[model samples]
Target: MWRFLSPQILFGADSTEYLERFEKRRAVIVTDEVIKNLDYVSDVSKHLENSETVTIRAREPCIDDALELAEEMREIEPEVIIALGGGSVIDVAKAGRILMEAEIEPEEITPFTSLEEYGFRGKTSLIAIPTTSGTGSEATWAIVLKNIKERRKVIMAHERAMPEIAIVDPAFVYSMPDHLVISGGFDALSHAVEAFLSSFSNPFSDSLALNSLRLILDNFIMSYGGDRDAREKMHISATMAGIAFSNSQVGVVHALAHAAGALLGIPHGLAVGAFLNPVLEFYAERGVERLGEMNRNLGLNILREIERIEAELRLFEYIPVSEIESHRSEIAERAMEDSCIVTGPFVPEREDLETVIERVVRRCMREES
Candidate 1:
């Protein structure tokens, strides 16, 4: 059976106001200290003044604090859960909520269990307001976290974890620094590319993935260069890509990033971008037919299909990165086990991952230096 999941999205300025309408006696705001300072958090708190609000200080979501937050929720008795930060905070919210509702260990919250059977009382509303328009956390059913004990990243994904509401306000986008803009664009790029080439991708998701990919390619550079119009398009595309990949799932780039992040705490965008081009070429063999279909939709010549996409997305970067080698072995092993790896048309084995890491390391260093 096929599943399609999406939150009821609220996009544009002041969408954070939806928090006030939350029908609950008490609420918990799961987020980081950084986001708490933003206007988004202040506005959400202001709106929900009638409802008791508690904040979980999850700086990076997957840290050891999640378990404590999970336990705290039981005492807080929050009827509603609102995620008001980036991917990290959103993930912590998901884990904490699931832990409370399921009354299970954090690691046991997997696809096999039926969470709805746990019977959360009331609407148990989940509202996600993304300060950054990437990771598709506002739109997707994916949850990523670092299992600090096991020293690995875990994904607790299910259709129901999809937020009841997704607030994608452009006003928040203006608050981003230049590094965040560049990094966020890369995250969205990986989502579009991985989903577009996913083995499980069907006609429905292919259309969304392709359109989002085009939008990112057309807008990322311009948006990063400070064009509001371009930034707006990219903001919209980030949600679109989230919806697409949520249906089809991401591939190698994500697999590598997940592994690298859990082990070395490398930033998601940089880790994903470091290996994107190599995996793109590797997946190209299985990706060509699907990519050709996208080219057909764009009315482009098939001969230069992926070439056009490369130019449009500026997909290749030969950065002379020296740090990747430090954790190379561990990263290789973890990437091999990532669930997203199997979804690639050409799934790389351990040897292949190692080889790709080597090439990416050498190439990125050359490009950056």
Candidate 2:
């Protein structure tokens, strides 16, 4: 048996106004200092008149951040928690809501664990409003928190972690930086690709993945050039990719990206963007059937398209290839431990992961040369 999950998604322009429908219930808006300074928190708060705000540091959230936010939630006892920012802010809210109700460590929240059994009854509803068109954390049940002490990323997931609502308004992303466009767009692209190649992929996920992939490819370049219409499509496509991956799962690209991000302090989207094509090439080298199938269905070689896009965007210029090469062994070891590895088309051994990382380094070096 299989299951599909998604939040009640409100999309398009002016969707943030939907928050005004909530009546007397107390609300807490969770965001970062950067987003708060952007006055987006004020915009959201205007709709949620009876609300409080909690601003976190403007960086990737760590486990301690989640725990601290959970403690604050417990004190506020809000009926609704609005996550307003990028993936990091949304992730903190998702994990924090559960931690507020359940006395468990963030790492203890796994896919197999029954949140209901641990007394979680959704006392607080989560609403994710992303300011960037990436990560798609607004639509998924996954939460990635930095394990500071261990120097790795801790992937936490559970059905209860899925947000109750997702507001995907393009107005929030109108002024997004060029670098964010590149990183976030590639992150969405990787999600669609990895979901299609995942071992757990099913018909439902297949359709969404393909549609999302097409939309991304069609719109990403235009969106990066500051086209509003294209940005809108990219925003919606990201949510579709999120739902696709959440149901079908992701593969080696994500596993390697997670490991590299944790070790190198690169942003999640940039790390995934850098590793995506390299990992896909690794799959192709192994004669992975899904890659060929995707190529045939898309009516173009997906790998070649990726290479073109990477070149057009100058993506390889951003990644520190030498630093990644130096930490190849550590990154590969951590990748083997990532939950995403099991869902990949083929479960790779530790040495196989190292080989993939080495290839990525070589490719980046070639690009530079």
Top TM-score model: 2
lDDT, model 1, position 177: 74
Model 1 lDDT per residue over 1-369, tens place: 997778898776677666667644477777777776664566676777545445666445664566777687778777788887777777777666666666556665566767766754334667887777678888887788777777688877776667888888777787587666766787887788778778888777787887887787777778877788778778888888898898887988899888877777667776776677776655455455766665667565433443454344444442225556777888888888888889876677898788778877766555445
Off by over 4 Å in 1: 23-25, 116-123, 285-287, 298-320
Give Cα-based local distance difference scores for all models: 0.73, 0.90
Candidate 1: pairs in clash: 318-367, 319-364, 319-365, 319-368, 320-364, 320-365, 320-366, 320-368, 321-365
lDDT of 2 at 189: 96
TM-scores, all candidates, are: 0.88, 0.98
lDDT, model 1: 0.73
Model 2 / residue 259 / CA error / Å: 0.9
Q: How much does candidate 2 score in TM-score?
A: 0.98
In candidate 2, stretches whose alpha carbon ends up further than 4 angstroms from where it belongs are none
- Model 2 is weakest, by summed lDDT over 10 consecutive residues, at 114-123
After TM-score superposition, the amount by which residue 357's alpha carbon in candidate 1 deviates from its true location, in angstroms, is 1.2
